[model samples]
Target: MNIIELFEELKIDKNNILLASPEDIIRIEKQINVEKRINPDIDVNVANNLILALKDYRQELYFIASNRILYTLFSKKNYSRHHFPPLQREYDAEKIQSFINQFLNDDLVLYFDQNLSQNKFDMINDIFDFKNCFPEDALFQLNKKLNIKLDSVLVNLSQNNSENNSAISYVEYRSFYVLLSYFSSIEMDDKIRSLVNIVSERYNANKLSDFYTTCISSMQGYVAFDPGLTSILVRNREAAVSNSIERSSSGSSSGMSGKSIFFIVIAVLKVLFLFAKCSSH
Candidate 1:
């Protein structure tokens, strides 16, 4: 059954459907025909089935649209890129609150409120907080906003188990790489190093080797470098060596020579450089 027929049978006004914009409605109409191709029998209860399917599709679209709106607002408030256009003047807090009241159900609002607390807007968790209304939807929106490809890895990582639920997921790793690329492009390697430090401490996963290997293997052909990522990596390694030296001095003397530390840092930096270069290629 077509979407129009299903809507008519369900007594739903196509224009007044909750949480759907005009473009979404048009896409829904097109998608219904596509869905019908999978079950073209058109049985006696076909309209009911179609209505159910369309409702599910509409809900999915609603989550996607809502995620995009929220992320856009968050980016505007936090990142505030000078090159990007300003958000619509109509999207102030009062206007957004009114829209939220009119459009979203209470359950969704509460979910968003709970998740918003977890978003520091400085790390991957800000984009993929599972406590959110729909974390998968939010991840998709973040990828769209950043123009990156990370959905497959994100899905896999979401299904895996981690200690303290704080293990670094593929989404987190890829986002860290992307952030490095972005900051490097803008000559902001310090920001990249700071963010990496924050994520490393927050997640506390002792799997840097695994993370590096997996990131390189998965993103080799799909990733691109910003020429600043190399600089970020070098600086990060230097900072790591400096911190190691400080800790060693403060604690027990392990007799680790300066030359040994220099070589170790170089080796680590070279590996990171290779990873970044391979991903970009």
Candidate 2:
């Protein structure tokens, strides 16, 4: 079936397409591929629209799928059970890794195409949103897979526009740091850390430090922050103090000690001063 015909078959309005389940998505892809194979002269616009829609639907589906997998692996109740039986734990870990790997591989192909666009970048951002929710080990594996894909994209983009002097945009820079933060959130192997250091050095050192700190602050209550990476990034005494102050203020408020309250007050004052400085500039 063609794009329009497929939508007709699905009985969904093209303008208000709801999320499709994985099974329905796979079937739609198959139908579209078959149609293209049978009719090489299919309208380009229709094909492109269908492909873009498919990407949107797939992103939602993948996000839900990844969240479910992570919940199964890292729920509080499973934590103790995952550790007690050594062999079974190993087996389960392998299974979980394999499942996650399949999802990542499929997602990479779906989202990262030869013609990179804003949509692809948005897909990466969405993936990171859910990927960060995973525990350290799983997050590490996901980060590795994602970084490999992103590196390939960067290489292709560079080769394709060798003479272009345009710098990465603000949104791209923000997304890049999100990926970096996730990668650094887990304990890294020597090789991975070396690779990350190289990537980190590509950006302005001070800007990178600020970006990393901002990322940590934004994700504060959502996921566990890795102090290991933060310590390495925020080396200046003043920035380190500011980060500690913010962290203390943003943390749970129950049963606060006098020192904690004092830090919160200082943090608020510092924030106000920073805002005034920016406004003045």
Top candidate when judged by TM-score against the true structure:
2
Report the number of clashing residue pairs per model: 0, 0
Candidate 2 stretches greater than 4 Å from native: 1-9, 12-108, 113-122, 127-172, 185-226, 234-281
Global lDDT scores for all candidate models: 0.39, 0.40
TM-score of each: 0.24, 0.30
Evaluated at residue 98, the lDDT of candidate 2 is 46
**For candidate 1, lDDT tens digit of each residue in 32-110?**
4665566564333544444443454554322322343343433222323452334333323433343333333343334
lDDT of 2 by residue, 38-112 (tens): 777665565655555556544332332224333222221222333222221112334334434433333333333
- Give candidates' CA RMSD values in order: 16.4, 16.2
Clashing pairs in 1: none
Global CA lDDT computed for model 2: 0.40
Error of 2 at 250 (Å): 31
